[model samples]
Target: MNAARGGGSVENGIANFAPLAATVFLALVMLLPVGTGVANVMMPHFVLIATFYWLLRRPVLMPYGACAAIGFLLDLWLDVPLGLNMLMLLSTRLFILSQIKYLRGQTRLVQWLVFALFTLILYTLSWFAVALAKRDWLPVEPLFTQWLVTTLSYAPVALVIGRLRRVMV
Candidate 1:
């Protein structure tokens, strides 16, 4: 049976995977050595942005399990304490879901502001976690720089993801 005849279609099935695929791609890209020195410290959290965008725009396609999986993968790749990224990503999803009603219909500026606020909170938590894991206090400058860069990069990342969502999902 065809989609018009009330059966699942191939395109629909593939589209359902787009969010996960895009997110994983972004996560991999985050591992690339694209910057130097301060630029490296300022590297935006592309995976975080992608996860947030997909969760906000299409929650059904980007669920908690997927978030956990992506985080786990990143933690392994980055050689951080296992589950650090998973915890952060899961926390982000939970926070966004709780505020979805308020976030869904807002303007881009409003959304960006909320994202910035959340990113600040998330990075703070991350800093604490890393410090605890290493049994020593870490420098705040890199975390602060990353938080600012990631927050600022949200708009463009969202725009690109939004366009991809329209075309693929």
Candidate 2:
């Protein structure tokens, strides 16, 4: 085992798990249905939430290129416009990093609240862009609903993630 600076160390065997887990998490998140909402099902936006986490805890781990790649993979996997998710992911990473100063050492509740607000903002911006260009509002409702579900999901995930940060980072 090699020790990272500041007393962090991991077995060579476990080093491979981080990216693998991210891949699986991305896969599962893309696959999972948001819920049974008749108007807004199939709306899980895990990439954004996952992006939120990486931006806060592992900026080096989940970089802009990684976000873009994941976004491309998501586009391929989900049949969406290429670069739609990529651009969103890129913008989101930038947004979070820009606001990174505000996230440090905050309570878990505060973190979640801030992220939820950020998610809502990103969703709105995306929807606004698409709506303006395509003259379609279909994405708006889904955006709101996905924010709700994603934020709700973020609470528990972040709690577990919060505990794991010291080890994961």
Candidate 3:
């Protein structure tokens, strides 16, 4: 009986960390060289997918602080303006957290649709922020391509995270 209780506790501890582990893992993916043939089509936003997934599915497990840390790390890894990704992620977290009461318990399709819409907004916001910081307007083509690719990436990435959640929780 003692062994069983210990095992349960151990499982619970690991379960608590599952969401965070998943998010960090996705952030690492953002660093990979997966650019497209297009002139400036950057890699899809893997970090956003993970952040949105955990934020929507298990907000308690994934805190805003952790999101900020991951965003900071991503900014460093991707070499973007310091705190740019951090601001983007924190804003996304806050936006979703505000609407989470309504989003919770909704069907997966609804969740995915909402996420796609959020991705659009996030990409635009990030693009504008970067441009404003640099004091110049960057072309929108690459940003649009990145947004489209990142939006398309949500389905597969969310499916993986959902499956992991089922096993972990």
Candidate 4:
């Protein structure tokens, strides 16, 4: 009985981290080499995509603490201002968590619209924050490209996250 209990505990531990593993994998994939080309000019924010996806799908699994930790790591890894990603991610989590009730049973189009709106807000906030921190207005082109690319990439990324959710949940 003790051996059986130990085996179950090990399984539970792995299960608990399944969501984190998947999101972290997606985050790493976002950093893959895409070469110096026009295609790589604008990269989608996969971490944001995955965070929003998991929070919406399984809020119980991806708590605010996990989201904050992921965002903090991203800030450190990317050498951005401390807490910038943390602020953004925590804000996103709060917004979605609060709205989960209304979001339930919604049509796909509605869900996508919500995601698009949040993505736009998230990008805008990042751009504004950077400008404020640097005390200079940055060029609009890069931020625009990133926002566009991320908004467009949402469908595919969300679809992949949905599949992963099935396995993890």
Candidate 5:
């Protein structure tokens, strides 16, 4: 019976690991579309936001190594400047990781407040960097639109992820 229990535990550990891998894989896949020859409109960075949540929620699982890997993938797949996403991701992770204490069991208002500021900062920084890197004299109109959509959508997604964790637990 003990051996059976041990074997089951091992199997379950392997099973649990699958989804984590899938999430990382999907994150990479999401960035790849921008690199292809097909014309694509710029969308808000989903993987960055999702990775931010996972890092804050479970830092042990989403360490700097994972974030760096994801950032490198973003650089390659999105054709963004090398180290642009890496720097953005690292700074953002550090900022969010610092606020994890306030996020625990917080009110919805608090979460929205935090995410709103963070998203604005992220979008603005990316906008500035892209404008510099690509040498495009584009305006900030689309940047704000993307920020609006991302901020409006990110909270609900994080909440759903939280709820899913509860159900699983």
Candidate 6:
């Protein structure tokens, strides 16, 4: 039966979890080792990209609770100050939701531009939070590099997720 009939099916349940599962998989991928060099510095925020794409394309699948859970997991794994990633992700979801009316139907280029701006703000805020927690000002270059890399990576991530969204959701 269909959801409109107030009946749920196994297929519907699996489809609903696809986005969250994909995002969690991405989070695990982010933890894999990358050899030292510029590649390390330029590592894209995989979780952030997935979070953004899912939040934009399927907000219901990526609710605030899921975001918090993902962020908390990242924080524990990465060993950063607790709640930093949570704050960033929650802020991202809130911003996207607020702008959904304007963002919907926009071209990929426009979406990329918006993501760039949003990533910049997120990275800047994260940098400040880390610096404050450590009681020392942190270097800005790596954060800037990560922001650029993450922003640039959004298009491909979005494309893949968009396809998944169509097929699954």
Residue-wise C-alpha lDDT for candidate 2, range 1-169, written one tens digit per residue = 2254455455534643564366448567677766565655554576677777767876766777788888888878876667777888888789778878878788778988998887787778767766766787664566777789888988766655556555654
Segments in model 4 whose C-alpha atoms lie over 4 Å from true places? 1-13, 37-39
Better of 3 and 6 by lDDT: 6
Instruction: List the candidates' TM-scores in order.
Output: 0.93, 0.76, 0.88, 0.87, 0.75, 0.92
Model 5, 1-169: lDDT tens digits are 7557655565555544433564465566465545345765555566666766666666666667767777787788778788877777777778878878878678767767787788788778888898898898669888888788777767776776666545544
Residue-level lDDT tens digits of model 3 in 1-169: 7556665676778999998898888887777776566754467778888888888878888888898998899899888889988888888789889999999989988988898888788888889889988999999988888888888888999999999999997
Clashes of 2: 0
TM-score between model 1 and native: 0.93
lDDT of each: 0.89, 0.71, 0.85, 0.81, 0.70, 0.87
103, model 2: CA deviation in Å?
0.8
Which one wins by TM-score: 3 or 4?
3
What's the TM for model 5? 0.75
Q: Evaluate residue 55 in candidate 1 and report its C-alpha lDDT on the 0 to 100 scale.
A: 81
Q: In candidate 1, how many clashes are counted?
A: 0
- Candidate 1 local lDDT, 1-169, one digit each (tens): 5878989888989989998999998887888888677654546889899988888988888888999999999999989889988988899899888999999999989989988998898889888989998999999988888898899889998999899889985
Per-model C-alpha RMSD:
1.6, 3.6, 2.5, 3.0, 4.2, 2.0
Judging by TM-score against the true structure, name the best candidate: 1
TM-score of 4: 0.87
lDDT of 5 at 168: 47
Residue pairs that clash (backbone atoms under 3 angstroms), model 6 = none
Candidate 3: 10-residue stretch with minimal lDDT = 33-42
Instruction: Spell out the clash pairs found in candidate 5.
Output: none
As a whole number from 0 to 100, the lDDT of residue 59 in candidate 5 is 62
Per-candidate total of colliding backbone pairs? 0, 0, 0, 0, 0, 0
